[model samples]
Structure formats: structure tokens, C-alpha cells
Target chain A: MPGYPPAALLLEDSMKTALRKKLLRDMLFARRFEEQCYQDYQVRKIGGFLHLYPGQEACAHGVMAAARPGEDYVITGYRDHVHALVCGVPAKEVMAELYGKATGSSGGFGGSMHIFDASKHFMGGYALVGGPFPLAAGLAKALKMQGRDEIAICFLGDAANNQGTFHETLNMASVWELPVLFICENNLYGIGTSIERSTAELDQYKRVAAYRIPAAQADGQDIEVVHEAAQIAVNHVREKGTPYFLELKTYRFRGHSMSDGGAYRSKEEVEEWRKKDPLEILLARMIEDGEITREEYDAWDEEILSEIEDEIVPFAENSPDPDPADLTRYVLVEDDPYVHGGPSKGGA
Target chain B: MPVMNIIQAVNSALDGALAADEDVFVFGEDVGRFGGVFRATDGLQAKHGENRVFDTPLSEAGIIGTAIGMAIYGLKPVPEIQFSDFIYPAFDQIVNEMAKFRYRSGGQYPCGVTVRTPFGGGIRGGHYHSQSPEAYFAHTAGLKVVVPSDPYTAKGLLLTAIDDPDPVIFLEPKRIYRAARAEVPEEPYRLPFAAAVDREGEHVSIITYGAVLHEAREAADLLAENDISAEIIDVRSLVPLDEETILASVRKTGRVVIVHEAARTCGYGAELAALIAEKALMHLEAPILRVTGYDTPFPYTLEQQYLPDALKIFEACETTVDF
Candidate 1:
């Protein structure tokens, strides 16, 4: 069995200059998109819990870069807008979903926390902690049973590891030798509680050792580091037909949700982590390597901001609210015999 | 037609599903080589191979959560909980995830998982081993709750449940798994999610399902001796409850006695009573009476006293007829 890939192969000349620039562009776009969402929530245009993915852009971008989007299955926790966008779900649909519009990915039924786009194979963004663990394993089991090479990629937070499903699924995934990559975006704190306080074993990757799965940790702030580690982990799972765990050491720059004031953490701690911002680190690396001029980077940023403002925002704002008359739709299959005429005033 | 017990009929239904669709999979603890603790999946693994019918880790959440995932990927999975009492661990997954998959995803993902588990008390099993939890799932929308009273209903209803394009909680009456024997069709068949009018009468109506259906039959026979005609209706499905059938029976009989093995508090009988009171209040000559277990945990030593028996059903029917 292959252990964690050696660090000697890190940042080899394998990543082309063009790909690196594209990743940076994607990460910047995601950051701007989340900022736009935060603004929309403040204006009451986006309702329900809004979990912005600002500081953890590199995690989704890096892992998705290593896997075949729209083919391999992807599942994640509620902090999932960026993951959906990276998996090829249109930004307009994701925004519309947050706005609870019919044009949204889930037809407005599932708001921010439950984004789903089956066409993109982005299975879903589950709201319950540790709920996606076994679902991801099931997806992998499906692929293996069908003799398909596609693997299932699951993204969860450090706190979700405390859920019993985390242990049950890992053991099953290892015992069955399913093809799955379990990505732990360790943002240090699960909401207000710090990892050290909640978990006895602070190292999330070390927890996977009990299941006898190969595991590693990577710098989540740097896209290059995340991509390289993800590539090794993804390949190991697909080739060996086994599970692998990859923990990204990162931090969320914002509160857990829109309602949170984030008084739990010290201001200095927040500022200290923000100093290693993922976007700034990537931009600095590109500048040092002369990949693009600073002026060009500024112009690209402006163009993305304009697109979000002019096109994406308008699409979500103009999308229609779901019809109340069709409130009971999708409760069952479309042609279900009991769909239109069945027991009335029952539970759901 | 082949005469088989409820366990054999369940195994036969699973056999037909596995042979009919390559996507259908049967899995649970001790279901593969051991043929399930109740043997409801006996000889399935051998006939369908390990991949199609296999055992899983002893985790209800893992069993159900994985079934949802497979269902999302366009596969049919029939997962079993060893017992209904042990299903609480996966309650979140079933209620929050599996039941809401179709609704939450806007129909993009229809989780057509058929969760099979044996429930109700008859043997000396304690509270943990015996529990009728159908009311819990029936209370939740987007889930179909079905219970089988005999071999014929078991085979036909199991097949229909697997074919339905929604999640179903297929609760089997373990008490009558072997005792309830009848002639079941040899080939695949489907039974709609409606009540079956087991016997017809006019004086009083006895509505029941699962193992208690047999008790209701005994109660009906007892009523017949007294020249008091009684009707017996087996509620095959609970969620998409056939209210019309129940109401028509209520309208004809003018008296009702609902029976179930679950506790009386918030039991399925409550729903039936409320529905009758709401829709057929004018036709009712007497208040709807319920024959059910007490609002207490199932007692191991006094299980017979705890469960609703034929005598209980007979007394409740007599009271309704006299009123």
C-alpha cells in the first residue's frame, strides 16, 4: 500500500504557468462572489444562513483541480457555495439558490445550505454535520460496483470529524476499499468552539490513522500546496481503489454564519490568520515569479467585479420566487399516483 | 401459487427484485452469509452473489446514509435495520436526509431507498428488541410507511415498495413472520398502497394492520358468534392512507375500533381516529375506540399483557357495538 506521497515532489515543474494563473483567477472570482453574497445578505436579498467562503478559496479550487469535475461525485458540508461553483455549477444559479428563486440549482426548495446540482455531479451540500461521510462512501461504492474509474470526493470541516458517522464511514470505506478522497478543511474552529477544546486529538489527519487509511496535511492558504497534495490523494484513491485523507490547515476569515458576531476568538488571533490570506499569498507568488503584471491583475479583478455586479446579481434578483400553488411539488416523484390526490394535511 | 410464511415471502420478494433489476442491492447486518437474523434475506446472497446481496457494518446511520448515496447515484438499495428499536441512531439520516432528498433537491435526486426492519412484540424480546415505530415515519411527509400482515401482502407489498419512486419504511411484523402463512404468487406482483378489506360485515368496523390484523380477525369471529356482524380492514400503507376506504367502512358500520401494537399515545390509531372524527363525524353512531398497548415501554416478561390481543380487540368492538 502507498503511504503519503513524499514532500520532495512538491511544486515540481508539473503545474504549467497558464494553469496557475487560471487557478488564481478562479480563487479571486470566488472571493469576490462571497463578498457579494455578504453584501446581499446585509441588504435582505439573500435569506437564511449565509456561510461565506472567503479565506478558504484555495481548498475547493485546489481539490477540484485534481479531480474530474462533472464526472466524479463531489459532496461537502454547508460551507459549499465555492465548491459548487468550482464543480461547474453556474454562478448565477448558485446565487439564485441563495435568493430562493425558481431558477436556482434546486428550484428554490433548498436554500443556501442545501445547494444541489445533479447535472454537475455535485451531489449536494448537506446541512447536518458528518452527514456526507457515508453518502460519499456510497457514491464510491456505486462507482466501484459499476466498474467505473470515477471516485467520490467529500469535503467536511474539522469539527465534523467529531460526529460518529466520521468514524463509522472511515472504517467502512477502508474495509470495503472504496475509491474516495476525504478532504478535511481544518479551519481551526468549528463555529465558536476551537478544535483543541472540542476534540481530544487535535490533529484531524491523525484520527484517520485508526482506520488504517493513508493521510497527509497541506497548506490551505497556498493554492499550489493544496493542489499538489490533493493530486496525490485523489490519484491514490482512484488507483488503489482505497480511501485517503487530506487535511488542509486553513482559517475562515469571517464568522461562522451571517448571524454570528465571532466574539469567541481574540481580535489578534483573527488578524494573525488573516495575514496569511489565501488570495494574497497566491497573488504574491505569481508576482514574484513574473507570471503577470500587477496592472493586469488589477484589470482582471475589476472585470470579475463588474460581471458579478452587472450579470450575476441581476439574474438572481430578477429570478422568480417559487409559486405557492405548487408548494407540494417535488415531495414525491412527478408521476407518483399519490402526488396530486392523496391523504391531506399529513406530515412531512 | 406457493404456500410460504412471511419470512419466505420476504426472501422471495427480494429474490424477484434482485433478478429483475441489476441495480437493486440488499444489505444489512447478518444478511449475507447468515441470511439475516430473521432470515428475511435467506439464500439471497448465494443466488445474487456477494456484490448484489451482502452484509454491512453494524451501523444504522451508515446503512441508511450509504443507501441514500447509492440511491442518488441511480441505484436501488434495500437496507435493513436488525430491529426497529435500534433505528434511532439513524433517525436523523432517515428523517432529515433520506426523506427530504427529493424535496430539498427539487426532485433532482429521488432517494428510492426501501428500509426493511422487523418490528412489534410477540416473543420474549425486551423493549430494545421489540418496538412498532411505524407512527414515527408515518408522521414524516415524503416517506411511505407500509406494513405486511401475511405472506401474500409481504411479497406483493415488498415488491411494490422497491418499485415505488420514493423512500419507504417497510416495517415487517416479526411476531407473525412464520405464524402467518398463506398462498403467495410465484411471480412478481404489486399491491397498491391501500387498505385491503379482509372481511365484510355491518354492525362494527375493526381497522388494524401488521400482526394485530390476525387478532382483529379473531375478534371478528368472536363477534360473529354473538350475531354482531363486524368488518375487518387491513391498512396496508399508512402514509398515503386510504381514507376513503376507512370512511366508507365507518359510514356503513357506524361504530369503530382501531387496533395496533404500538403505544396508545400518539400512535397511528390517533391519526385514524382524528381523520374519522373530522370527515365522518355525522356518520359515527359512537365514539371511535382504540385497542392498543399502554403508554409504556414494552415489557419483556409481560409482553402478552403489553400487546393488544384478540380479547382486547373483541372487548373494544363489543363496547363500540353496544354504544
Candidate 2:
């Protein structure tokens, strides 16, 4: 921001101001939302597993910022509230989803890890690492068939790099020239184990080039850096009808999940990463660019904090739970209209 | 109507599906150009072009996962896993992703792909190529597990599997791929996802599906030779478990002998036996008998011994009727 980055230069001053504010606010909203989720988890308001997306906000917000929502497909592993939020799924509904309320994106059927809104083109909250790779390829295949330039963004974890699907889907995506961006969120650690202990080759995108697909990595802590990388990946796949792999080098501020004791990593290492926190970096950049003063940054933080506290949480809490009868819904349907959960038959 | 083997009928059914719906396409290992290992999708790539029918990398997970993505994008993708034994690579996709898509989406998305895989023993494919894994798919809730006994049913059931608005695991008995023959209609005719009694009797009901049905028939013949009437119940569809038709047959027979080529432990035959014990136990003339493969893994050389043969089924039927 200090030296007029190329991405900012491509946009008008007003457009740049609007986008920068949007990116910062988007990242802040995600941070505040996940923080609220953490609080809710502590109070037992959020049940099951809770994976927060605080430090890696740039990966979600930046990639989604480069996306054409409602046209492109966005899929991610379990740490996915931010993906759903960035893709325009109602923040209140996402909160409701975590609360297991029927008003959630997946109607409470998908709690914490599984959130899908077809209307928003937010594909799914695949809880399995490397689970969404093939699906992302298929989504990109569908876009290719429909003659659309929209790409599918698949957010896989660093741990997922060793999965057979990681290699299988990447190979297929390359062979078929599918329009998918396999964004590996290399947050240094997978759950508790560091990447060095997990994957043999630490540079994931390098191995991805085995399939001959163009691959690169970005500083996922910097919003502008991530945005630039994602834009290149998105534009390349959208235009070339091929796949691109981007490894976002970032760190998770919190444990892999709520249950982790943070005993796996060192205090010094955590402190070092926290120093380059994406939110703080973006805030510093915005302040340095004269887009916002420190006072305005603090004020924006307050607004986002209140937005989640006063608005989203209450909506999620007040949301209804699903009926017992809807349990067998969406199994199979007749071809006439493609419906789900047919008339009740005598139970065996 | 033309007489064809299970492989031809399967190919015809795929061709029909491709012609019926432009959105329908078939992809798998050796499915295109080579027309599949068994030629089940034979001449399909040539007829339908490389796009509609194509070969895939020898990655079952990739094939199934790609089909899922295509299915979600409004396409009827029929992905073959080459052999059911080889489907383990794609198990995560089939079980975790495809099977759970619709229910997890709360009716927003339906995993409408038909996973056609050749399964069952007697092909001498050892552990890697020959195995009956229908129980694995049947045990899964959201998947439709169909094991056809003949060509007509194979074609019709494949058609139905493709048409069903959910994922289907079409387990073709590789043992009877070319062994079984029937006059499948040239034009596509939908088959009901219900059991059909190939041969009906009253004393001992030999319930089976896939390749084991042949053994069941031989056992029925053995019973006929002994002046015993055996009602052979072919379990056409495994998942929905046509308990009504099966129980009706069991009620008439008063005794049951379940037969399968899968391992005795947790095999589909156990489920069938449990179903009879649960719903129609009062009508049981004897403790229901299971003529099944050994608990050990399918052996390469000892397959003939490992798989349940006609003699084993016949002996079981005789024991059931005598008891």
C-alpha cells in the first residue's frame, strides 16, 4: 500500500479505497465471528468440534475476494465458517449452523464442519482433509461444460498433502484441464503436527507441478499478497481452462480445534507468527496508505465486534431446530422433478 | 429382444443412458477405447465419442470423485471403479462425500452418480480384482446397492441406477459377467428395485443374489433331485431390502437358506438371515442356514474352495428342509 501495489494500481483510487476497506472489514468480520465462536464454544453454546479461522483470514478473504460469487464455486475443509461467510452466506446463518440450529446454511444437518448453500455457490464444508479436491475438479468440470469462465476454489489443508486424493485429484484436474484452484492453506501445522513431520516435501506446490500444472506459493499472512496470488490463479484457470495450485504460507493463531492444548508448538514460534498477524499487517498497511487512521481501524473493529455480538449471535440462538421427521430427508428422489424424502412407508 | 450376456447388456444399458440423456456420460479405468477389462462398456467410446465415454487414470478415487463433481453440476455421471475390490481407493469419496452429499446438504444437493463396478469372486483375480464388496456399499445408508443376476436385470437395473436421483453402487458379478445370458429388450425398460423369484418352491427358500444365485439354482436342482421343492429368492436390490417379497417367500417356504460368496462374517447373507430372524422368525422351520464363503480373505488359488459352491448351498438347503 505504501508503494502502490500492482493490484491497487489496476483499480481507480475510489475503487481501491472501497476494495481495501472491504478486504480489511471482511478479514475483521471473519476474525470477530471466529472469536465469537470461540466464546460460544467456551459457554457450550457451540457444540461438537470448533475450528477457528482467525489468523488465516487472508487465505479465505483474499481468494474469495478474487472470486465472482454466485457464479464460481468455493469449497473448503472443516475450518470453513470464513469461506461460507466470504461467499455471501448470511453470517447469522453460519452462526446458526455452528449452533446446530435449523436456520443454518445446511439446515443444522451440517454442524461446525459441514456448511453448504447451493444458492450462494458455496459448495460444502468437507470435514475430511483432501476431501474437497475431486469435488472441486468436478465443479470446475461442470463450469467448463456450461461454458462459464467461473472457477472452483478448493481450500485444502497442509495435512491433506499426503492424502492419496491430493495426488489423484490433482492429476485428474490437470489431465482434464479443469478450471479449479487448489489452494493449499499451509498454516505450518496440520492439527498439532508441523508440516515437516507430515509431508516429505515442505513446498507443496512444487510437488503439485508433478502433474505439469502451473503452481506458486504466497505469503498468506499478507492480504494483498494472497489477493494477488489468488487473482492470478483464478484468472489463469478461468482463461486457460486448466488447473492452478497455490500454497498459502500462513500460521494459525489458535489451536487446530478448541480441544487442542497448544502443547505441540513453542511459545516463541507462536509469538513470532502472531507478530505477522494478517489482521494487524492489513491494518498497518491500511493505516500507512492513509486509507484509515489508527482511530478508524479501532472504530471498524468495534463495529465488527458489535455486528457479531448484537446481531449474528442472537439470530443464531433464536433460530429453530429441525423437526425429528426431517431426519430421513434428501435420501433419494423420483426423476420426474428431482425431489427428496418421499412418502412414508411402513418401517421395517 | 436380443439374447446378450451381462457385459453386452451393461454396455447396451450405458449406450441407452448416453443416448437418452446428453448429460449422461461414462468414465472409468479401461472403460473407453479398451471398452473396459471385461468389455462391459465395449464399443461405447467409439459409438459415443471420447467425451461421453472415456478412460480414466487407474485411480478409483479420482474417477468416483470427478463423477461426484459432475453429478453436482447437473450431469448423470456413471463412473466405474473397474472392480469392486479396487474401490477401496475411492471409499472415502463414495462413503464420505457421495453418500453424504444429499443428506448433509439438507436436500440442496443430491449425489446422482451411478458407480458401476464389477464385483464377486470366481474370476481368479485374487484379492485385488475378485471380491464381493456389496455389503460395504449396502451397509452405507445413502447408497443404492444393486447386484444383478442376469443380463435383462443387469441392463434394466443399470438403467434404473442411472435414473435414480441418488448415488447407486451397481455391483456386477464378475463371475457371471459372460456366464449369465438373457433376452434383454433392445429399448430401455426400467426394472423395479424389487426381488424376483427366479424359481419358486415351498419347502426351503434359497435366498441369494449375484453369482451365488447360480449356486442357489444348482442347489434347487439338487433339492428337486431329492424330491424337495426349493424357492429361490434373488435379492435384486440389496439396500432397500425388499423385505416384503423376501418375507412373503420365506413365509411360504417355512424355512430359509441364505447364500453368498462374501465372507461369512458381516457378509450380506448375515443381514438377510438377521432380517428373516427379526421379521419372520415365527415362520422359521429351522435356524436359518447360511451357505457362504469362509471368514478368510478371498484366496487366489483356493477361490473355488473359498467361494461357496453349489454343493455347499445344496447341503445347507437339505439341512434346512430336514430340520
Candidate 3:
């Protein structure tokens, strides 16, 4: 912004302006959406476990910015409101999903963690830690078998790195030369434990080289940095039909969730990360580079805040709760045409 | 037509499916270069490219879970579990995901794939390898369970199982993999899931499947020598059981004995016994009997005692006639 950095010159002014506006809108929408979830959690409007994706908004928005909407598949862990939102899941529906309403993405069956919109190509928001790993690998295999150029994007936290499934999935993805982008959102701490204390190899993408897979590490806090790095990784995955790994180094601003007491990390560390907030950084750049006036950035923030106030929360509040009778509707099919359920008049 | 064993029939079925449909692919442990541990998928990788027939990581969950995803994307993936005993690791994938996918998705997606596992107690595989777990799957709603006793039915039924719209659990009796051989049609054929009446008689009815079918046959032979006529029925498919054929045989025979190598408490045999008792109760001359493996942990050393053999079937038949 100050001196037209050589890397920054690669993007034209109009392209940069449009990208900045979209990134701000999506990231701010995610932030405001999750912030409303925190409020809903306190009021008990949304029950069960709720994981927030506050500071890691840039990672989801940045990656989806590079990947296609309907063509690609997106899978992530429980902290997936932002991922679903970035993939074009209506903010109101995602909020209602957290509320466990009938209008939610999964018809209130999956609650917060198991949200899925097959039509939108958001494969799932699997609750089990690292449970989506093998599924992502399979999705990549399916895409490859169908001779499609689309890739799969799988998001995992730092804690998932310790799971054997993580290794198993990566190895299988690499061996099959599947088109998948494994995005490890290294937000310093997984749930509550810091990465250094839990994980042996802190640099996760470097671990992929042992499996002969291509990988890179980028700053997760910077939207443009993440977007650019992801573009390269996504392109490489699509062109080569091989797995690509990305370890985005970022930090979560809030506690793991509304329940966390913030006892796991220091206030000083949290403040330090908050200082480099992605939204603030983008706003500063937009102002300093003369890309937009301060009024525009203020207007964008107002729009996100007003949308969260007037759209997502109100829609969730007005949404109907799931009917008790329909609780067991999806559990099993009452009449499966494939297998005769009750009695068969025997004859071959 | 070609005469082959159970394993050879499986290989033929896989080869035929792969050649017929470009979407059909096989992957599992030792399935590619080694042609599978039991050679059930023999020579598939060589004939088809590695892309179609490949070996996967030694992970049951991975194999089953990935197959679910592949099936959702319109690919017909036939994953091998090496052995039925080893499929427990994938129990969640089978029970939770694959079994419930169609229903859970509100019919938006169906897990239309096949899982081929070798089952039954023979060849002295002991507890780990030699066990019949069909009852567990039979309890599942969305799954189709079929056990092929001989090669001819193995090929035809396996082809049908592969092409079935729903997920099918094709359990081949590993004990009879090479022991049982028959002439199978060279060209494709289909075997309906209903029961096949092997021998027709008027005195007693013997309903069985898999390894127990051989015992029933031997017992039927012995009953014939003793001047007692017995009808033999082989239930090719356990889930979509051939109740009509079984009831018809029992009505004619006026007596029934259900046999299976699985534990006695609650097996597919129990289901068959209840079905006969419910439908053809008026036709019964005596009470229905069941001769099954004892209800105990499949003992490693005492497998012979734990398993029901031809002698037990003969004893049960005699008791049924005496009653």
C-alpha cells in the first residue's frame, strides 16, 4: 500500500478493489454471524456445543475466494459456520442451523456441528475432531474418477494433526494423486492446548513432504496473502490432480467458545493477535492505499452489523423449532424399496 | 460355462463387473498386486489399471468410509474387507454412515456399493478369522445380506449383489472357498435373492445356508438312507429371505429344522424359525427345531466342538421326526 510492493503490483487496481470489498463483506459477515451465535449461546437460544470461528474468518473466506462454488466440495470440523457461510450458505439458514430449527441446513438433525448442504457443495460440518479427513480423501477420489477438474477443500484445526486419521488420509490422498486441498488452520492453540505442547512437528505442511506431497505455509491473518497462496495451491491441485497442503499460521481472537474461560492462554497473547486483526489490516490498507475512503470501510462494517441485526438473528428468531414427531424421520426409512423389511413370501 | 471355486467365482464376478461398467472399481488390502489374501480378486489389477483395481491403506474405516463417499458421487466401489472378522473396525462406517446414508439424506443419496467379505468357520482360522457375523448385518435395515454356498450361485448372486440398488453385504463362505466348486455360466446371469429348494421331499424340511447347507445336505442324505424323506432349502439371501419357498417346503414336509454355523441365541436361523412358525403353523406335524453353533465365545482350540456339524443336523432331524 505504501510503496506498491512488487508482489502487490501483480493485481490491477480495479481487481484489488473488488477483491477487497468481497473479502471484507464475507469476513465481516462471518464475524458478525459468529458474534451473534455467542450471544445466542448465553441466552440458551442455541443449545448443545457451539464452536466459534472468530479470528480464522480470513482462512475460510480466502480459500473459498480461490475455489469454485458448486463445482468444489468443502469439508471442515465443528468450527464451520464461517466455512459454510463463505461457501454461500445463507447467513440466516446457518444461524437457524445453530438454533436447531426446522429451517436449518440439516433440518435441525445435525445442529451446529453436522450442518450439510449438498446442493451448495458444502459436504458437511462433521463434529468429530478430524473425522472429515478420510471423507475428504474419498470426495477427492470421486472427483478424480468422474474426470472433473474440481478439487476438495478440507479444513482442520491444529489439534487434528495428532490424530492417526490425519496421517492415514494424507497418505491415501497423496498415493491416489487426488485433487484435494488440505488446509490446516494453525490458530496457535487447538481448543485450549497450544501447538508446541501438543504437536511434535509445529510446521505441518513440512510434514507432508515426507509423503511426497506438495505443501506451503502462509500467513492466515492477511486476507490477500492467504487468497494468493491458496490460489497457487488450488491451481496446483486441479492441474496435477495431486494433494496440496497449506498450514496457515493464525490466532483465534476469542476463547475457543463462549464456554471457555480464557484460562488456557494469556491476555497479552490475545491482545497481540487482536492487534493484527485481518479486518483492521484490510481496512488500514484500503485507506492508506487510497483504494477507498474511510467512509466506505465504515459503510461496509455498518452493512455487516445491520445485516446480522436485521437479517440472520431475526430470521433465526422467527424460524420454527423442529417438530417432536419428526425427530425420528431421518433416522431410518420406514419403507425401503430395496430390502423388503417385514415379511417375504419365499420363492426363488 | 466354467467350473470354479468360491474364490474363483468372486474373481470372475469382479472381472465381469469391471469389464461391463467403467464406473465399477475394486480397492482394498492386498487386492491389487497380490490379488487379495484369498485371491478372490485375483488378476484384477493386471487386467484393469491400478486406477480401477488398487490396494488401499490397511484401514477398514478408511476403506468403507471412502467407498461411501465414492458411491455418493456415482461410482460403484466394491471394497474388500480381507475377512469378515476384520470388518469390525469399519462397523461405524457400515452401521452409521453407509447403512443410514439414504435415509439420513432423506433419499437424496443412496450408498449403492458392495462389501465383499469371506465368512464362516472352516480351514481352522480359529476365533479371529472363522466366525459368522451375518446376524449383526441382518439386524441392519438398509443392508442386504447374501451368502453363496457354491460357485455357480456365488458368481450369479455376487453379480446381482454388486448391481443391487442398495448396499449389499456379500458374505462368501471362506471355509468353502476352494472346498466347494461348481460349473458357473461364462456369460452373465442373475440369481434372485429368494430361497432355492435343492431337494424336494415330503417327510421333513431342512432350511439352511452357507456352510450349514453342506451339513444339511449330508444329514438329508443320511435321512434318505434311513428311509426318511427330507426337503432341503438353501437360503441364498438372508435379508430378503425366501419365506414362501421355505413355507412351501415346510408345508409339504410337515416338519422343519433350521441350521446355521453362527451362535444359537439369535442368528438368521432364529428369524427363519419364527417365520415358519408364524406362516405355516397349521401345516406343522411337529415343533420346529434349530441346530446351531453353541452360544459361547468362538473358542480358538475347541472350534470343532463349538461348531455344529452334519452329526448335529442329523440328530436334530431325528428329534424333529420323533416329535
Can you rank all candidates by TM-score, best first?
1, 2, 3
Q: Write the per-residue lDDT of candidate 1 for residues A256-332, one digit (tens) a residue.
A: 88866776678999999899898888888888888888898899999999999999999999988777544435646
lDDT of 2 by residue, B122-143 (tens): 7544445567888888899899
DockQ of candidate 2 (2 decimals) = 0.02
TM-score of chain B of each: 0.99, 0.98, 0.98
- What lDDT score is found at residue A198 in candidate 3? 49
For candidate 2, list the clashing residue pairs, or say none.
B201-B231
Off by over 4 Å in 1: A1-7, A339-348, B1-323
What tens digits encode model 3's per-residue C-alpha lDDT throughout B1-323?
Answer: 67888888889889999999998989986677657767787789889998999876546787899999999998999999877987887898999999998998899997888999988775444445677899999999899999888998899898898788789998988878898888988787789887899888878898888976887888889998998888989999998887788888988888888888887667787798788878988998887787776554443324556566777778777887887
TM-score of each candidate structure, all chains considered together: 0.56, 0.54, 0.52
DockQ of each: 0.02, 0.02, 0.02
Provide the overall lDDT of each model, using Cα atoms, as 2-decimal numbers.
Answer: 0.86, 0.81, 0.80
User: Over the stretch B1-69, how does candidate 1's per-residue lDDT look in tens digits?
Assistant: 779999999999999999999999999766776677677887898899999997765457878999999
- Model 2 lDDT per residue over A1-348, tens place: 021135553344223778988988888888888999999989988865678988899998888778786668999988888888888899999999888778888777677777888999999886555668888989989989899878898998877776687888989998998999998998877664466644578887888768998988878898888887777778888889899888899888998878677766899999999998998897887787788998988898899888888999999989877664454344334233422211111122
Q: Chain B alone, model 3: TM-score? A: 0.98
Write down the worst ten-residue block by lDDT for model 3 chain A.
A339-348
Clashing pairs in 3: A345-B244, A346-B242, A346-B243, A346-B244, A346-B245
Regions of model 3 farther than 4 Å from truth: A1-15, A337-348, B1-323
After TM-score superposition, what is the CA distance of residue A202 in candidate 3 from its true location, in Å?
0.6
